[model samples]
Target: MLCVTDRMKLIHTKGTQGIRGHTILFVVIGLLITETSTQAANSTDEELLNLKLRLNTWKNRYRVLCNKYSELAANSSAPVINCTGCPDGWFQVGDQCFLLTRDVRVDWQASKKKCAEIGSHLAILTSKEQHEALENERMRTRVAYTDFWIGLTDVENEGDWKWVDNSMLKTPFWNTLKSEPDNNQSGGEEGEDCAVVDSKSQSWYDVPCSFLYHRVCQMDAIPLQ
Candidate 1:
């Protein structure tokens, strides 16, 4: 009876030892699985963080581009302004300046257009003073070769000689022999009823206005101050 009881006790001790080893192994496996899962989760989080950082970088670049576009768009629209320069040589008229070129060979109308382009009119001898001014200019320049054009024409009515500026010829300064036209006398061999200044001799001439010649234009020096 004593031998049987010792054997049974040994069996129970062995079974308990085997059960404890199995429990320890199961605990180690559980710990390894938990560590692997945690490591995967940490890696996924790091990858997500990097992706978010990249997205933010792209967003910043987009914002910068938008700002630059807005600035350029704002600056594109503006108004153009007009500016004028002083005309070449003559003297200042009322509000413009003038320049009389050395006598050029152009027709009467061409001469007038040339002067107008430079912001003035042909030498409109409006007053005796203005006529004297022309005579003086001719004397000073010593350009007395032939007749030159002045601001005079009879475009509308025959015999009604008028300044190219359309002002009436109230004053007279005939060179002794010739005079204003006797009739409208539409342009004939005399071109048009235009004026010319004989640059060499400094005498005025009533040539056909259509004849081409060099002429003068006037400008306003400053505002009529």
Candidate 2:
């Protein structure tokens, strides 16, 4: 596992299933290094093209990490690395920030609290563009919601489902060919307020705010220099 950290004092958290996650990253890095070191050996254009692509990807990943590191390190003693790559837990969402927390189900309020405890917030889809970005990042098919929690609800009004961030939910989307819970039936009834982005193919689903969901959290990405 690559357990490099800025401060030796900072305890090593279990970094990304490192032994496994890093296998792919390291293989790619090694390929580029070997290719560059052996450049005079007459490499194939195919190998060179692959190297260029991989290097470009790493550079882009580094840029994203640098931005994130900047924000988290600001106004603190937090030191930043020149380029070790993106933090283990996070995945990139276009220029946004994302982390795959797996299937941890928690109630709306509790989920939000947990996200903060981890230095983040429950996933907040503030716009259609962001929603599209998230789908692309996750490939939208592998994960499950079991009705996961999202940053939206009518804590203010009974029927009005708005994003917790107060961002407009202008884009209508849903799973199971259903738009949303009408809030009329009484199975997992009232006060159960929270939203779930379902189908991994459509917009998302908003049920009672109280239903526990396999949730994901998102945080503000560090700004680019």
Task: Identify the leading candidate in terms of TM-score.
Answer: 2
**After aligning candidate 1 to the native by TM-score, how far in Å is the CA of 144 from where it should be?**
4.5
lDDT of 2: 0.64
lDDT of 2 by residue, 26-124 (tens): 999999989887875556766888999998898788778777877788868997544332345566554456665675566788887887887877776
Expressed as tens digits, the lDDT of each residue in 1-225 for candidate 1 is: 559889889888898989998999999999999999999999999999999999779766765665665567668764322122343346543334445577557877787788777667777654454544555665776655445567777656655778876778886554535453332245574444666655443445565666666676665453210
lDDT agreement of model 1 with the native: 0.62
Q: How does each model score on lDDT?
A: 0.62, 0.64
Worst-scoring 10-residue span by lDDT in model 1: 79-88
* Deviation in Å, model 1, residue 184 alpha carbon: 12
In candidate 2 the C-alpha lDDT for residue 52 amounts to 92
